[model samples]
Target: MTFFLQNFFNGIMLGGLYALIAVGYSMVYGILRLINFAHGDVMMMGVYFAYYSAVVFSLNPILSFTVAVLGAAALGFLIDRVAYKPLRKAPRISALITAIGVSFFLENLAVVIFGAIPKSFLDVFKDKSILEKTITVADARIPLLTFLVIIVTFAMFSVLFFVVYKTKIGMAMRAIAADIPTTSLMGVNVDNVIGFTFALGSALAAAGGIMWAMRFPNVHPYMGFVPGLKAFIAAVFGGIGSISGAVLGGILLGMIEIFLAAYFPSVMGYRDAFAFIILITVLLVKPSGLLGKKAIEKV
Candidate 1:
């Protein structure tokens, strides 16, 4: 029972992290109907930003994290303005290709700037207590970082839900998602809203990336690639455009991965493949996803 509880807790922690990144994917897709392949790279950049802030400038961990989130948000906004904005009027295929290009660009840029080596995230941070400490419960020892990650994830999601449902900008976002032309005719600044969407999504991705680095204790140029892809799968699994769905999908995926690896140690190496299998199952069983509504396009 203790072992089961431990795995369950770990699953939740992992799920929350994935949900954080998945929300970014879902948000961008919900608003623009475009899959931002560069979203994960934006997360990688955030980790580097935090890394440099702490190592080079010698800033405290909290300040470094703040800088990371803000820097990634700014990067997201810039990507939209520079790469995606111009393609807004073009076909979606164009934007999709550009997203891929942007992703590659960011990855290579990191390689050029931060080098190809992996850095230890905890070793550089001045404060390691958050991650180094553990709490005992019913014979199960859990990292304090796991609790922190879960709490922060929930808090962030609360703020996100509030911003999306209770605020004016959120209403604008919803309007834009429904019909860009109609929203523009409604006198809303569609471009600003779209840019804000990108910024918001990137911020969440950065937060996820920070937690992810802490949990894994490594930061590399390519670190975000697989997690980013899995988060996209989670987004699609739960219903790509639904915020709640993203959260649900991430949690489920995380749990499945953890449990599968725990029970079938031999298959640990193939754990990553499980995500693709789940993705295929979801697509075949329900193309619209578990929480997604089917769209009825008019001719």
Candidate 2:
């Protein structure tokens, strides 16, 4: 029972990170219907940015995270301007391929620049009171980090919820999501909205990446690979275009992976398999995911 509780806590903490990354996927899909394959690499870039800021600039973790998020937002803006904007009117297949190409380019670029060496971000976890502490409940001990994750997730979502549903930009974003041509006809700046979407998504991905690096402490050029895939799965699992759905899916995925790793020792060796399995299972059982609404075709 204690073991189970421990694993459960671990899963929740992991879920927080997944939720962070997953929201980005859901947001972009909600607005643009594009997967933004490069989203994960954006997170990787955040880690690198934080690393450099910490080591080179001698900044503390908080300042480093701020710089990383800002850098990611800028990078995301550039990606939208260069790779995706021109293909906006083209077949979505073109945009999808471009997204894939962009993803490849960023990953390879990281390799070229940072090399294959994995960087250690041990200092991120040094401060126990901030985001890592231990508490007991019903034979289960939860870490302070778990609580911090819960707090951060709720805070982030609350802000996002308000921004997407209540603000003027939110209305414009939804308008674009429903029909870009119509939204454009209404004199909305579709390009700017798209750029904002990328920036917001990238910012969330950056936060998730830093938190994840803190938890795992080891980051490589390809570190974003699995997290990116899992986050994508989370977005789809809940509902690709649904913000709440993405968060729900991410948390659930985190829990499932944690349990699978704990109870099924053999599966640990092939951790990535769990993501594929869950993705397939969700598709087969409930295609729309837990919080996702079914998309209706107008054709």
- 98 in model 2: Cα distance from truth in Å? 1.0
Tens-place lDDT digits, model 2, residues 71-161: 9999999999999999988999999899989989999999999888888876443454554457888878776767767787777788788
Regions of candidate 1 where Cα sits further than 4 Å from its true position: none
TM-score of 2: 0.93
Note the Cα lDDT for every prediction shown: 0.90, 0.86
Off by over 4 Å in 2: 123-133, 136-139
Question: Candidate 1 lDDT, tens digit per residue, 145-221?
Answer: 87787787778878888998999999999999888999999999998999999999999899989889998878989
- Which residue pairs overlap in candidate 2's backbone? 131-145, 133-144
How far residue 198's Cα lies from its native spot in candidate 2, in Å, is: 0.5
